[model samples]
Target: MNLSPLQAISPVDGRYRNTTQDLAQYFSEYGLIKYRVFVEIEYFIALCDINLPGLTAFDKANYNKLREVYLNFGETDAQEIKDTEKVTNHDVKAVEYFIKKKFDDLGFPDFKEFIHFGLTSQDINNTAIPYTFKLALNEVYYPKISSLIEKLKELATAWKDVPLLAHTHGQPASPTKLGKEFLVFAERLEIQLNSLKTIPNNAKFGGATGNFNAHHIAYPATNWVDFSNNFVNNTLGLNRAQHTTQIEHYDQFAAQCDALKRINNIIIDLDRDIWTYISKNYFKQKIKEGEVGSSAMPHKVNPIDFENAEGNAGLANALFEFFAAKLPISRLQRDLTDSTVLRNVGVPMAHTVISISSTLKGLNKILLNEEVITADLENNWAVVAEAIQTILRREAYPNPYEALKDLTRTNQKITADTMAVFIDGLKISAALKEELKQITPYNYTGVF
Candidate 1:
């Protein structure tokens, strides 16, 4: 059968392809191959810049021509590399050969040997993977997360004055501003996202076994370490791991995984809260004309968007947890386990994109059911008992805590009139009684 979205085995490419397709440029097979080619070409160009032996005679004008090998890279170029991979049984080796072929075609055949010279497969894989991951976050993931945060801020600002009956351990506890609640999530997400940005995109580039074994043996007098540092750091804009085995240590990458998992966890928390709000009629979803919430139910507008976001964020977090725990450890110097696992880095990323988009969609659809929110505040007048008790404590009222607890902690419903009657019965000044009676769920919401 022909390849299509429907034929994809993973939902990232299948069920939610449209939501995640933007990531294909960074995480797809073609994307990796293209980056590998780019790294090889740039490494060769870097060698030429250093006037490394025979490369000194190479024409500087052909640098752009060399860059075009990857700048103009397409599916056909990737397929050519894949076909070469089938013949060589090595992915990075195929990339090297492909670049050599490009050199021959571009009339720089004599200098072709310098492409990916003295490098192990991990060198290309590590550098190319991190570079692509960095670009993906900067170009795609960060923007999506920022959009969600901005949406939360916008909602928070809009609802800043609206009072909500805050729940503690599934019971009404105090009144809080609706906007303040939204701002809490916005602040949490922004802080985590800032932390995530601080982790450097690191890559291992010191040839086989990370000692420049081949490059150093070929030129014993040259400082390969400094050369690699300049190439990886300056040319590629990535941090080079100073010490390593066959592959990168993945410590920073693991930290990134943990950070992303934290962000997804926050999204999950927001999803559950909004879902609960919908359930309690504090918010209503803006329904389309013909949309059906459930097949069996005729009158239902379920919080499916939040549910979708929660489910996808959970899946992303699970993969992120595994990556954080697994990628940082390998048997001794190297192992094949991380190689296959690294390929799926895009899976969790794609899911995260889906979740963020779903969350934005859910946020857009929500309409504040102000009447219900107001009614809830009115019905939960017992929440004002805390304010009254605190004020009474300031006034040095005898047994104020016990008094409010006795009045609130009972089967008897606490109402405005009940609070007023209790306040009138208090053995305090008439002015103090008026101050206590003024406390209500509506205006008793604490400051942000």
Candidate 2:
């Protein structure tokens, strides 16, 4: 049985492989191994730069060669590390062995022992994962989100003056410009995205028990705390958690997940609203030839893109919820719960990527049915009752609300003509009557 899309379990890696291929460089097993290699090599270089007593004998000229082991790491290197893991029975230990093998190959065997000195698996895992996430956010996720935002902005500007009948409690109540409604989503996404930017890509770097217990024991004279902080903050470009158990506190990571969830939630809201608009005939989809909308009905052009986006967004939010709620709660010192869960960090992000792609597709398919929108507003003349009554009140017309209510209610099909005729018969002055008559559903929209 050869590997195929059908053979894979998760849809993100399987059915939707093309949609999420970019994430593989940051979240795949190969990506993880490569990141581990990067961290190990960087740690070794940092130690050498610190000019530790025992490590001072290494050749400075060979530093570039040592860095190349990871800089040019490939599938063969990753597979070699996996093979080493089989013997060591520890992932990080395997990385250390792999680096030692590289050093031996490069004729710097004496410097091999310092490859991963005084570091726990979490130290490697924490830094590598967050670094991968940070790069992925900058390289992949942020671009997709920004593209979606730009698409929404374009639609907002394009449809700024296109009137849409507003629905309140499932009934037509007023009218609003279609573009302004899109701007609402753009505003929501921008705020949440800014918050995500503020969340520091934090990582854990202390030794076994969140304190550099072993490092401090090995070199009592060195300021291990300052060293750890600098290595994590300056070298890796991540925020260092000064105090912790064996793992990162994940508070900031949880903050990031929650923020992503909120953004996905907003997309879900947009999906549902757009789906409703499609259903109400305010929008029609530009169909692709040979695409099936339904198995049974031939006269169907369903909003599957929005539906697909909604479903994927829901799945992403569920995983994000678990990540936010569960990752931050571990037993007293440390636990293995977060380890397994953290590996799937890319799952929610993959789903989010899928949803964003689907949403973009949906946005492209939509062709605004302006005629239907205007017709809906023109037919719902009773909506302007509020506007007319307010003006009547301003003119000191007694019983204005009661009069409009009587005229609108029990009149199942109110039209612009009916409202105009009724306004002309009002006892108010001709000027007030003309003002009331001028108020149509189209112009009754509060503000564009």
Candidate 3:
């Protein structure tokens, strides 16, 4: 079968391919080959700049031409490298061989040997993956999520004065403003985004055993550690891990996953809250003409966007949990487990993108049902008991908490008249009774 979106197995590559196509340039097989080629070429160029013994004759003017090998890399080049990998059975080695062939075609056979000098498969794999991963986040993920945060801020600011009947333990409690509630999520997301910024995009660039053994053995006088650090950090814009066995230690990778999981959890929290709000009839969705809410029910308008966002966020978090717990561990120095697991990094990212998009869609669909909301506030007169009790306590009244609790905890439905009657019978003075009556659920919302 031709591998089109319809034929692909994973929904990310199939049903939702359009939602996550931006990630293809960072995590696809072709993307991996392209990055591997980039790292190999750049490493060779850096060596030329360093005056490595046999590389002094390399023409600096041809550097642009060398860079073009990867910068202008295309599908044909990627497929050729795949063909080479079929024979070598080593992906990174195949990338090196492909670069060597490019050098021969470019008429630089004398300099081709330095293309991947003194590097292991992990050196290339680790460096390329981290660099590409950072780009994907900075370019795609951050912008998408930040857009959601901005939308939330917009909602919060716009609805700041809209009173909300707050619920605690699924029962009416104190009242809060709608806008202030959204600010809660904006605050959480901002904190997580800051944490993500603190973590450096890290990679491992040492030779065989994280010691640069081959490079050191070849050039004892050279400062290989400083060289690798500068090349990985300054050149590639990633921090190089100083020590490892045969592969990147993956501690930072785990940290990245944990941070992202916390972010996804926050999004899930937002989804669930919005879903609940819609269920409670506090909000109505905009009618998209011809959109079906249910197969049979004509009056139904389901909160499917929030539901979709919640499900995808959950899926993303599960993979993130596995990544956080599993990637940092290796069976005595190295294992094949990380290799296979690492490839799926894009899967969680795709889900996250889809979830954020769903959330954005849901946010845009919301049309405040003020009639229903106002009716809820008007009906829940007992919610103002906390405000009345606090005022009575401020007036030095005795047993104020017990007074309001006894009035509110009854089986009888508390109305404005019921509260007024109860307050009139209170042991407090007339001024205090007047103050207690002033409290109403609609205006009793806490300061935003």
Reference-based TM-score of each model: 0.99, 0.97, 0.98
Each model's Cα RMSD: 0.8, 1.4, 1.0
lDDT of each: 0.93, 0.90, 0.91
Worst 10-residue lDDT window for candidate 1 reads 106-115
After the best TM-score superposition of candidate 1, give how far the Cα of residue 444 lies from its true spot, in angstroms: 0.3
Write candidate 2's Cα lDDT for 1-448 as tens digits. Answer: 6678788899998999999989999898899989999999889888888888789887677778877887899999898989988998888888888888888988888778788899999999999999999998999999999999999999999999887788989988877889999999999999999999999999998888888888988989999888888989999999999888899999999999999999999999999999999999999999888898889999999899999999999999999999999999989989999988988999999999999999999998999998899889878889999999899899898999999899889746888888888888888888888878888887776766
User: Per-residue error at 293 for model 3, in Å?
Assistant: 1.1
What is the alpha-carbon lDDT of model 1 when measured against the actual structure?
0.93
lDDT of 3 by residue, 332-375 (tens): 86788988888888899999999999999999999998888888
- Candidate 2: residue 394 lDDT (0-100): 93
Clashing pairs in 1: none
Candidate 2 deviant stretches above 4 angstroms:
none
Q: In candidate 1, what are the lDDT values of residues 1-448, reduced to their tens digit?
A: 6689889999999999999988999899999999999999899999999999989999899888888889999999999999999999999999999989887888888888888889999999999999999999999999999999999999999999999999999999799999999999999999999999999999999887889999988988889999999999999999999999999999999999999999999999999999999999999989899899888888898888889999999999999999999998999889989989999989999999999999999999999999999999889889999999899899888899999999998999999999999999999999998888878999998876
